[model samples]
Target: MPTDLVLLNSRLLDPGTGGLLPQTALAAADGRIAALGDDRGIGALAGPGTTVVDLKGAVVVPGFTDGHLHPVSGAERTMGVDLSACKDLASVRAALDAARRSLRPGAWLRGWGLDPNAFGEQPVGFAAVGAVLDGVPAAIDLFDAHSMLASPRALELAGIDGPRRFAQASEIVCDADGRPTGLLLEDAACALVEAVAPVPTEGELLDRTAEVLRTMAAAGLTGGHAMDGMRLGFYAELEERGELALRFRIAPWCQPGADADAVAELVRLQGTGGALWQVAGVKLFMDGTIDNGTAWLERPDCHGESTHAFWPDPQRYTEVVGELHRAGVATATHAIGDAAVRHALDAVEKARTEGGREVRHRIEHIETVPDDTVARFARLGVTASMQPTHCCEFTRADHTDNWSRRLGEERASRAFRCRDLWEAGARVVIGSDWPIAPFPPLTVMAGARHRRPSDLSLPPHGPEQALTPLQALQAYTVNPAWTACEERQAGRLAVGFRADLTVLADNPLNVRDTELRDVPVRLTAVAGRVTHRAPDVS
Candidate 1:
């Protein structure tokens, strides 16, 4: 059978073995690999209508998959002022001042990627940037996305005054005087301000989201396990319009108070998808984040916080997990603290032991787990979906960062145990929880190998926790496919597998950790359709 697309003059690399096959070309038809062999042999299989290209000896491997991310939410959050590059209070103020200047009359200023570290000695609050935000009604999200700093005016617009109670582990932070400080912790608290914040029109959001997905494709991500399914309609619209660039496996949220009906709805949502997108699982937060003092730490932090789980009733969470497991629904729970990780693991263990099913369940952000928790992942068959960049960009090696300071020395030392989990025989997958971290797959792979910041100037946070280059590659390629039960159909360059592949300027395994993040992506194809081709690539 004639192939629909052919690529010649390429090096076929196997992510699993760090090997290069003798074949220099491959062909794809009907969105899957049709043939692979020498350039002449595969080239001859191209049909008259086939699109053919010469790679000039570029390296090709199975396309990278972000083991976890929130694509639609990331796009929406980042559409406003970008404070990610701001390093200090002065820089943050300067950026907000600039955005304030450009604001239309009475327009609320919205921004995201505000780093809490920028506050230094001061606490994260509206007052930190209030000088520039007066009368602006601004709501800026901290980098974690679990928290937000709302200006007083924004608070008033949202009708918030003093502290409020939440069913989950969220808080509208109050000062010693019991007055709102503008620092909202966790989703429920942040939603108070977000409810009043301006939102883009549906068309506008759809267009911006499409652009972001293409940008992710350009970064060599052919697919992502989208941790949020709030925008399933948006994905469906894009898929119907042929604008969806990445394959998305969406998991909608199953909140703390989810009833039997909610659990059943999530099960029914299974297999709901379009050509390149689907509703496959459910997302639940076991806890919030350490930076905000909302994570369920086994012990209290320096501020006597983070001692509680997101769910008010902890056993209810276990029950929900078991219910989902019995119904054959896989779950990805957000568990950053040690207690949260242990509980999530326990829930999965219970679900597995009782239900005895082959569901592929996973836990996200195993941030500060102990040695015992690490071993349980493999034993319980739970995949560890970690965002390495969260360690690389957020925390510090000397324990000076807020995340480290809050946990103190011991708990902080166990940060992001990627290598520990992998060595313990657990299936570890890497990702960029985009908007929380950058979504570039190579940067994520590099962070897994180099725990230090991208500049490589700082000392490695947990040098022992660094993954080998090949292991990092497999985390993004092979492991993600296995977690999704698509290993047989994707995650490799074999014939008959999905033609989801990435063409890189250099072999990722051979590139230095510092250079890997910047490695040029020559081409990215999802299901045989080229979504991103460098202008330089012929």
Candidate 2:
């Protein structure tokens, strides 16, 4: 059959060699690569209906895949106040006041990206929040999504009269007199406020997702491993309707109290995931993020004080993990502290011993770890799903930020061990942690490659842990596909693989580290169809 599309006059960069292939054109037929050769050789395969894209000598590489992110939640968060830029209470109030102007009557005020650490010495309390929101009901999530601040009206609406007991580690921070202080830590506590917040409807979810995925496509993301599971069908519906352009692999939350029977049920349910969509695994929170002092740490340091695991029963967690793996389902766990990382590894080891499955299990957000644990990832065949922007946007180089202050100097210096994990032989994959941090892979690559200090005034944090450009590129491209067991279907540009490619204005492999983010994406194609093209791309 004649080729459906011919991408010519481009540099086909080989990720493995960090060099361009001698063949400079690619032919796609039936949504797969048909041929790779010189412009004339591949171009000759193009028939009358074929779309021939003139690349103007741009660099073409495999489309990027985000290792971890919440697609549904990220889209919904954008509907409310984006407090990501707010640095103080007054600014937060100003942002809320501005956001409220666009909201409907009687609707609750909602906001995201609130970082209490910016307050420096100021208190974050209901009184402080109520002063800004006034009588309006409001719920503001912390940047890490591990905690939240609720206005007095919002608390009343959520019926959080006082601190309540939880099955797992959670905190409804209160004052000396037992007055609610507006801070809710961990999912259980955060749920108190969320229980009252309005959930997006099915239509809203699909619409919001379509809007966000387009943004993602233009940024060169050809696919994502979405951490949100219940929304899998939503994306599938979009794919069915041709609205979902990017490929997705969904992992729904695997909660406690489920037994081996539940794993069996999950395996049966997994069949629902199709080509553009898949329910490949379950997502479990082993520990909260370090930002709110909720992370599970072995020994408490002044910087991050909590030593509690999110799971009520560690034995149950291990059993469930083993059960799931035994059934051949992948698992992705959220582990930030060294203790949590160690615990996760132990569980995987236990799973392997019993089930003996070779499924890819990942440890998400490895913010800190013991030196010995670095080699354990590779030895145990674990993937390190890390976010470089977490280090640059949140942690401080001088060990004074919220996270660094919690761990103290000794442990803080070892945070986000990206290079160490890779050098130790672990499959290191990178993601944005979106809404928590920016989602652009190129911008993320800048952080991975440079470890630039959040504040240029300060020194770079853990520059020794920074990744090389090639290593960073692979993290966004090849590593993620491998993590999801889609290496043969996607990740690389080759015959027999899906014709998903990202064209860059400049070759990142040949550019200076600082210039990576600035290099624009000229075009993005998925399955031989052009999803996004720069206005001047022609």
The candidate scoring highest on lDDT is 1
lDDT of each: 0.90, 0.84
Q: Residue 193 error for model 1, in Å?
A: 1.4
RMSD of 1: 1.0
Model 2 agreement with the true structure over 1-538: per-residue lDDT tens digits: 8787799999998776787888999999888998999988988898999988889999999988888888888888767788887777778777878877777776888888887766656666656644557777788888997888888888889888788889878989888888798899988898988988898888987898898989999999888888877666686688888877787778888776667677677777664776577788888888887777788888986743668888879778888888889888888999998888999999999998889669899999999998889989998899999998888878778876777877888889898999999999999999998878888789888899888743444567899999999999899888988898888877788998988888998999888877788789998888888888999976
TM for every model, in the order presented, reads: 0.99, 0.96
Clashing pairs in 1: none
Q: Output the number of the TM-score-best candidate.
A: 1
lDDT of 1 by residue, 1-538 (tens): 7577799999999988999988999999999998889988887887788889899999999999998888888889998899998889999999999999998998988889988999998988877765787787988889999998898889999999898888888899989998898999988888988888879998999999999998999999899999998878998899888889999899999999999898898999999988888899899999999999989999999999999999999899999999999999989999999999999988988988999797889999988987888888888889999988889888998999999999999999999999989999999999999988888888888888989877777888898999999999999999999999889998899988999999998888899987898989999998889999999888
Q: Report the poorest 10 consecutive residues by lDDT, candidate 2.
A: 451-460
Q: Give candidate 1's error at residue 442 in angstroms.
A: 1.0
